[model samples]
Target: MDKTEILNNICYTKLVYDRINKKLKSNYSKTEIETLLFAILKETHEQDFQKIGKNFYVSNVRNNIKITINSNTYRIITVDRLIKTKK
Candidate 1:
């Protein structure tokens, strides 16, 4: 699958997005945040965080998060959802 297809299969939810968004606001680049968010979704769906290090590019040393906003900004919405209709 292509990168976008791989990313699309990630299946991000609002809860996961909030947790990741807070991390992005702290100290993460766009790439790092995306990797972290993917890792989170993978873990939540699989019930473990074992392969995060191997699968994601973000280093474990910097992932220090405590409080989460529980908002819906972390998840990268699909292209279809992002486009706005012109009146």
Candidate 2:
């Protein structure tokens, strides 16, 4: 799905919330996550999208975060912090 469509139709399941809570470093409320996602996604560039299997992964390098979303269902799978490591 396109960025706009994904934004407009973004959804979350009960299990998804559980997964998200365990995934993120900080504990964020459901409302907080939704807001954060909307803001980040609204500013997403074309290069942020990555398709793997049936999922769409949108990442923002500046924020050091990545979000996994189901393409067909528009459900947010999880959020991950992009940890940096020195060479």
Candidate 3:
């Protein structure tokens, strides 16, 4: 599929966008999210991902940025930040 088609196929909920904007303060635009999703799909092993349930997966894009998605639907459920503890 082309990049635009691939991007259109991936979905994100309103709550997910809100969290990314407000809580995470990432201000991630749709284009940025689309690029990240494309990267995840293209090279999943390169991204840090953990299976949380039968159909749910959480991927860490960066040290702090994380995204939870439904494997079955390919829908982004939430976005949040990982808290880092100082040694």
Considering every candidate listed, which one attains the maximal TM-score?
A: 2
Worst 10 residues of 1 by lDDT: 65-74
| Candidate 3 backbone collisions, by pair | none
Local accuracy of candidate 2 as per-residue lDDT tens digits, 47-87? 78888899999988877788998988988988898778789
- List the lowest-lDDT window of 10 residues for candidate 3: 1-10
RMSD of each: 15.3, 1.5, 4.9
What is the model-wide C-alpha lDDT for candidate 3?
0.59
Off by over 4 Å in 1: 1-25, 46-87
Q: lDDT values of the candidates?
A: 0.37, 0.84, 0.59
| TM-scores for candidates 1 onward, in order | 0.30, 0.87, 0.59
Rank list by lDDT: 2, 3, 1
lDDT: which candidate is best? 2
In candidate 1, which residue pairs get closer than 3 Å at backbone N, Cα or C atoms, i.e. clash? none
The digit string of per-residue lDDT tens for model 1 on 4-86 reads 34345544544544445553445555566567656644443222222222242212222332212112222343211112337
TM-score of 1: 0.30
- What is the Cα-based lDDT of residue 21 in candidate 2? 71
